[model samples]
Target: AFFITYTYPRTAVSFSEAMDWTPGQLSGNFLLPSILEPGQTYNVRARLETLEDPTQETDTDWGVITIPEAPPEVPPAADIRNLDFGAAGGTYEIGER
Candidate 1:
């Protein structure tokens, strides 16, 4: 008899329901929710059951799922400060200094 099962890692609120599988082996890509924020974590779970006889069938296994944090955010160039000496110099006066 052959059986198939899937498992996911712990993650944040964002998670993927659609999964895929290969021949004999189990594998799939998860589409995470867009609402999920970057750098956040989540948990996931999955299970498999056999369809043999009621008395013979059993819950094969169970595991936890995890969703990785999103990529880092890049700041705009305009928001960055220009530290070049030639660009500008200190504006402090003798009294201010």
Candidate 2:
């Protein structure tokens, strides 16, 4: 039996699942839950049990993983070269030029 656990840093969010192997099963897969956020870091670890005994289990050190962050957005730019400030002080909104 194999037990895997993942935890988000600095919060109470976590997800865990288990897998049991038969006599000939060699591969398994676990789908990530939707509660996890993107670009956030999380700690992960796994424990393997032998003969369903708690005292005969092995655990790995916690590992770090981070999801990719979204790309930045760029605003539109104007190409006006010459501008007149008129007289002294005045409030100007966008596209007032």
Candidate 3:
């Protein structure tokens, strides 16, 4: 028998389930959640155990890295050509002009 385990580094939640495998099945597939935290990595893998004894089990290496969320795009700042004293004039002083 085998199962899948998903670990969340930021949260205490753990999702696990038994795989639907046949007596001679060699391949399997799993679908994970679509949305994950940005700049974070989650752990996911499989585990196998003997039907006769559950204690005799092994864990496979983590084989997937969830796609990271892209950072927000920011526009470039505008350059200030000169200091302009608005209509409210109060003896404005320009420096290094």
Off by over 4 Å in 2: 1-27, 64-97
Residue-level lDDT of model 2, residues 1-97, one tens digit each, is: 5544654333222223454333321233444655566566555554444544557654444542233443344455865675555666789566855
Candidate 2: residue 42 lDDT (0-100): 55
As a TM-score, model 1 comes out at 0.30
Q: What digit string (tens of lDDT, one per residue) describes model 3 on residues 8-91?
A: 432222224464443432343344554544666556554455544557654454553333344444566866786665687488
Q: Candidate 3: which pairs clash?
A: none
- Alpha carbon deviation, residue 29, candidate 2 (Å): 1.3
lDDT (C-alpha) at residue 87 in model 2 = 68
Candidate with the larger lDDT of 1 and 3: 3
Per-candidate local distance difference test: 0.45, 0.46, 0.48
- Residue 48 accuracy (lDDT) in model 1: 44
Ten residues in a row with the worst lDDT in model 2?
8-17
